[model samples]
Target chain A: MKLSIIGVGLIGGSIALKLKEKKIVDFVCGIDNSQDNLNEALALNIIDEKADLEDGIKNSDVIIIAIPVDATRKILPKVLDLMSDSQTVMDVGSTKAGIVESVKNHARRSRFVAFHPMWGTENNGPKSAIAESFSGKAGVICNREESAQDAIKMVETIVESLDMHTIFMNAEAHDLHTAYISHISHITSYALANTVLEKEKEEDTIFQLASSGFSSTVRLAKSHPEMWVPIFKQNKENVLDVLNEHISQLKKFKSALEKENFEYLGELIENANKIRGILDK
Target chain B: MKLSIIGVGLIGGSIALKLKEKKIVDFVCGIDNSQDNLNEALALNIIDEKADLEDGIKNSDVIIIAIPVDATRKILPKVLDLMSDSQTVMDVGSTKAGIVESVKNHARRSRFVAFHPMWGTENNGPKSAIAESFSGKAGVICNREESAQDAIKMVETIVESLDMHTIFMNAEAHDLHTAYISHISHITSYALANTVLEKEKEEDTIFQLASSGFSSTVRLAKSHPEMWVPIFKQNKENVLDVLNEHISQLKKFKSALEKENFEYLGELIENANKIRGILDK
Candidate 1:
């Protein structure tokens, strides 16, 4: 099989490497607008060749869109228009509702499968790609019923070959749950980084006194803004909903602390501890 | 030198192990309110023997109080009252201002050193202790002027021997900085955990789509309430001030998302990205 991957950054580069390593793709070609990214991906053996999107779509059996969420919405329909019934196209963007809706009425809608692999790091770019990036993580497949059976089966086979568990959900449900579980985390981290950076003027003291818990909580603040800004925009409503609730929760905690209500603070923390049960599952 | 560690739980037990492993102390004894914790500490070889507070204070050359903040405030005065000029006493608690103020005018204040080691995990109790736990972390020695010169020297040597850098700060400065850097992180995490748990009812969905970012942001929510409650209460004013700023930051992000002001959101994230400089330092 031959594959064409768009973006050619962290997720795209990692997918290309994993496909070649597993012998699932005989040749993998990449399409990226950035010359530096294309050159780096080629130097790292992330792709067999680089080609334009038109040539990539015409030649490969599969085309994977791994760009930002807004870019995915713009380019997915174009790819769907160019795709044949025998070819498959999939997107690995974080938000699914917009892209899925934009392509729903297209002639070749059945050829597209929307997927989100629930794995990433604070780092980005082709150099950040790892060969075993997706192992042991869950890959969400949104609106599978709209896609062709063969396309769904092939996507499942590819994801499973990379050692990922697949879960199915509608685009609306996927966006809502992802806003709660994933997007809010990024917002909280960014706010936390900003809060600490605002007050702790002495950078040396922050570096010296930072504990593992602080590091862990603020790790996502290092994520690329180009990629995340589009995600926050595409899923604006759900993200805003969760963000409002999150702020309210923080206000309650502040009030409790101001009142010196240790018992209430303890109860809140204990209730939050129930997250262990959900995560441990 | 013989050492006695009060409150034979996570922090105290870990310190005992490191002292024993480095052969800095000829014998290690433990004193805990809970007999089970004492037995567990002994079983794990965190200490060689168990003793009451008075016995431990009188017989040992050095006494380490590693307990919750409230307990530390109540116990430090008693320990100082029983101390001799040849013996050094130190308390390892998260909040420094309250503990320091509680013993400020005590006659034996010169024999006591107030220290806060900036290292810990979400897990607690004796079983959570790890060997060489405080290595490479920063140890904050608060109000050094209140401590005898010899006591300060001895405590500094012990912290340095554990491969840690010692930073000197007054109690007020220490509490303010810790509230901004450490305490606020925990509050945000706990509130975030509760927010997500309240909104996302499908536990299976949360388990499936949750990313490393979510797990890291919520990790501090798993911390024991008993360990954190007193810390919050002790540093209530500083924690509330930082918490208010944090909530205001989140509200700004929420409004930006609500208004679809991508430019403002982008700038907010870009500004937050400046944290990389501090973290990398």
Candidate 2:
């Protein structure tokens, strides 16, 4: 099978490399706006051929849209317009509602699958891609019924080849759940980083006294704004809902401390400990 | 030298194991309110012998107090009361101001050192003790001027034996800095966990969609409240100060999202990205 990975960045390059490693896809055409990224992907052997959008879309049997959500919304219609009925198109965007709605009325809508592989790191670009990045993670396919059976099968095959389990859900539900599980975490990390940066004037002290816990909590602050901004923009209402809940949750902690209510503080922490059951680690 | 580790759980057991491994202390007497912990420590070779608090303090030349901050504040003066002029006592509490102030006017105040090893995990108990847990981490000694020269030297030597670099600062400043870098991170983590648990009622969905980013941010929520509540109580004012700053920072993100101010959101994230330069990873 031949695959075309648009954007040729972290997630795109990772999926391409994993499919090639599994010998499920023989050729990968890299399509990216940045020539430097294309060269880096090609030099790193993340793709077999670097092609322009037209060539990349026409030559491959499967096309994956792996870019910022805003960019994906703008280009999905164009990507669908250029694809033949036999070719399959899938997205790896963090937000699914806007992308699915963008091409809902297109003639080739049946060829596009709204898919999101639930895996990423603070790093980016082709250099950060790993063949094992998606292994054991969830591959969420939203609005699966909207796509043709052949397109769904193709995307599922790619997800399986990458060693991820499949999860089917509606586009709206996916956005809502992701806002809670994924998007709010990023906001907390960024705000936490900004908090330390705002309160702690001594950079050397922060660098020296930073424990493993501090680093782990703030690690997601290093994620790219270009990618995350679009996600917050597209999922604005849901993200705002969770953000409000998160702030109110923080206020409870503040109130506990101000009141010196040790009993209430302990209860709050014990309740948060309930997450241990939900998270594997 | 003979050593005593009061409250032989995670931090205390870890110190005993490492000192024994490095041959810095020949004997370790474990003291704890829980007999089961002492037995587990002895079974794991984390301690050589189990002793009551009186015997543990009187027999050893050095005493290391590692317990909840509230417990440490209550027991530190008594431990110092049992020690001779040649003996030294040090604490491994997260907050320094309260612990140091607890015994400020004691006759043997100079023999007690305020020390904190900047390393920990969500897990606890003797089973969680590792000899190398403090390696490459900071060992902070607050109010060095208040500690006797010999006591300071002994704690510094133990820090070196544990393969950690020593940092010296005043007690008040240490509490302030830790509130920004460490205490606030825990609050943010617990709050983030509670937000998700409160909002996302579907546990299975969270388990499936929890990304590496989400897990990293909320990992500290698994920390034992027995340990954290006291730290927050001791450093309540500083923690509250930073927590307020953190809430305002988060409100900025919320406002930006609500108003669709992508530029401000981008700036917030870019500012947060500065932390990448501070953290080694």
DockQ, all candidates in order:
0.84, 0.85
Candidate 1 runs further than 4 Å off = none
TM-score of 2: 0.98
- The local lDDT score (0 to 100) that residue B199 gets in candidate 2 is 97
For residue A42, give model 2's deviation from the true position in Å.
Answer: 1.2
Worst-scoring 10-residue span by lDDT in model 1 chain A = A254-263
Interface RMSD values for all candidates: 0.8, 1.1
Chain B alone, candidate 1, TM-score of: 0.98
Cα lDDT tens digits, model 2, A156-251, are 999999999999999999999999999999999999999999999899999999999999999999999999999999999999999999999999
| Predictions in order: lDDT | 0.90, 0.94
